[model samples]
Target: MAVGVSGDDLMVRVGPDATDEVLGRPGARIFDMTGRPIRGWVVVAGSAVTEDEALGEWIDEGHAFAASLPPK
Candidate 1:
């Protein structure tokens, strides 16, 4: 549950605690599939992740956040 692809956007599981900061990043926005925005997730514009390093960074953030959560 680290990252996902939604159309052309990159979905990141950044956790609710970091939602505001993540959203403040360029091309970042709350992920919304059914009108309501999902907590702990964000959709980054495809254009923002053109660089491999940038993409990796986002995925790392997502992975880190996911790791912080308790296992089901």
Candidate 2:
């Protein structure tokens, strides 16, 4: 639920609160497989995540958001 991969892109579940902010980041975009974008989810370009720290930060954001949700 936190992180995924679509082709070379990195998918992250950052939740609604951080969606806007994350979208402004380099190579970040709304995850839009359907006609409309899926809120709280983002696709980060592989180029932007070439560094280990950058990749970790995004995954951490996703983990934080997922952790905030109520248990299933």
Q: Each model's TM-score?
A: 0.93, 0.95
Taking every candidate in turn, the Cα RMSD to the unseen true structure, in Å, is: 0.8, 0.7
lDDT at residue 15 of model 2 (Cα atoms): 90
User: How well is each residue in 1-72 modelled by candidate 1, as lDDT tens digits?
Assistant: 899998889999998889998888989999999999999999999999999998999999999998988999
lDDT assessment of candidate 1? 0.93
lDDT of 1 at 52: 98
Listed per model in order, the count of residue pairs whose N, CA or C atoms clash below 3 Å is 0, 0
Each candidate: what lDDT?
0.93, 0.94
- Candidate 2 Cα RMSD (Å): 0.7
Lowest summed lDDT window (length 10), candidate 2: 15-24
Top TM-score hit? 2
In model 2, the runs with Cα more than 4 Å from the true position are none
